[model samples]
Target: MADVARIAGVSSQTVSRVSNGFPGVNEETRQRVLSAMKELRYRPNSAARALKRGEFRTIGVITFTLSTTGNVRTLEAIATSAAQEGYAVTLLPVAVPTQDEVRGAFSRLGELAIDAAIVIMEVHLLDEARLSLPPHVKVVVADSDAGDRYTVVDTDQAGGTHDAVNHLLGLGHATVWHLAGPEESYAAQRRTGAWRAALEEAGQVPPPLVRGDWSAESGYHAGLLLAERPDCTAIFAANDQMALGLLRALNERGRKVPEDVSVVGFDDIAESSSFQPPLTTVHQDFAEVGRRCVEGVLHHVRENGLEHGTALVPTKLVVRASTAPPPRKVIPCS
Candidate 1:
């Protein structure tokens, strides 16, 4: 502090004010202080500042896995929003999804230098972690039904799924076939439930669900099974990666999308637009979800209580050439 003040030809108090973003300092003084800080490669000690302020200006992000699109995108949005809010993000990765692993992470909570935490994982893992954290620790969750337990920021899973299913049915398909992710997945559960509900509401019997492990390979295998079913015309895949594999399977089986069958997927990933026939999908506002997670945590940290419940971010159905009116006659799907 002394060296920076000396270099900038200002008092230490002036440097402090500039660093803290106090408004009293003139613009020129602020620039000089910042320039001096840059020249000296001076970085503020967040831990010390947090201690002095009685709040760590850091957020702990505990994630089970980053392999999935939703996880990765949500994490990215969290980091971006945290950075914009002048907070550091600390990653706490749980290699496995076991209760013990989650509990272990919770045990380390006291040692982490963070004011609040945002957890992204399935409901079961979240339950274990929730129990292990300090009773007063502020938390925000990104997936699953945390109910009244914690502040939650999630996409409109049910609404998006309903739109996808209804979109297919509205296009004249008698019923929509569903490609669901793993049963334990919260997003998958919501999507699958909505798909079935939409079908039942329309007086159409929902087709049997084809389960996938969220891997494109699993989607490919599920696709092959669907391809063999003559009644499967319109497919709603849980994600874009799975839809990609489904596309391949359909192609190999001589099924022309929109001609013989139509497909819609979730998570309008970048590659969905480039798929062979392009893909229609539900676009989850991951950026908004992430922003809300940070807001929920910061709100709790400031207010010192969990007074909020689920904050929903809306999803949209992106229509493209992949979806169309079903063929008039019974056509061989495979």
Candidate 2:
């Protein structure tokens, strides 16, 4: 600092202001200090600055898996939002959703320099691993049902499902069939419940539930069975990938979409619009969810206290070519 100040013909205070990017330093002086810094190859000590400020300017993110579209997109949004806030993101992927694995992740985060953490996983394990989190680190949860225990930012899963079912029903389908994701997923569970409720609310009986592992192959198998059912008019898959497979099965089984069977899917993934027939689906704002998670984390950090509640990012129902009223039940003249 002193050498740079002397070379730049500026006071140490001026150099400090320039290095820290504080205002009031004219362009010429700032350029001179920068040039001196370049000549000396001087870089500010981030660790020392962090210690002095009592903040690492980093947020740690703990997630179970990145294979799912939602997780990957949400993670990307978090990194982008954090960068905009002048904070860096460090990710830790848990190999499993077990309590022990979650605890291990938190323990590892505790040893790092992150100022806070945002957890992206089911809250059941998080409830058990709550004790393992570092005392000084604030936390915000994403895509989980921990609102009563911790701050949570998530998509309106139930609301989105209701929109999907209602959209199908409003189009004149008697009832909507659901192909759900794994039972263990909070999101899948919420959507399933909402589907059933939406049907019952509309005075329609809910049909048997179909289960999938969030895979297109599972959707294909489910579609084969559904294709055989003469009464199955409208179907809702849990995600876009599954919907793609469902479309293929329906086509191969001689069921034309919107002509024989209409289909709706959740998660308006990028490829959904290009499906054999563009899919009508629910659009979850993963970017908004991620942005809220970071905002909640920083709020806790600034106040030095945890705020427990759920913040839901709204979902939209995107109508496309895949949905239409059920095929007319033609009857022969008696």
Clashing pairs in 1: none
Against the true structure, candidate 2 reaches a TM-score of 0.95
Q: Give Cα distance to truth, residue 259, candidate 1, Å.
A: 0.4
Point to the candidate with the largest TM-score: 2
Candidate 2 contains a number of clashing pairs equal to: 0
What candidate 1 gets wrong by more than 4 Å, as runs, is 3-11, 27-43, 126-133, 331-334
Question: Which TM-score value belongs to model 1?
Answer: 0.91
Candidate 2: tens digits of C-alpha lDDT, residues 193-257: 99999999999999999998788999999999888888899999999888888999999999999
Alpha-carbon local distance difference test for all models: 0.86, 0.89
Q: Provide backbone clash counts, one per model.
A: 0, 0
**Candidate maximizing lDDT:** 2
Residue 70, model 2, lDDT: 90
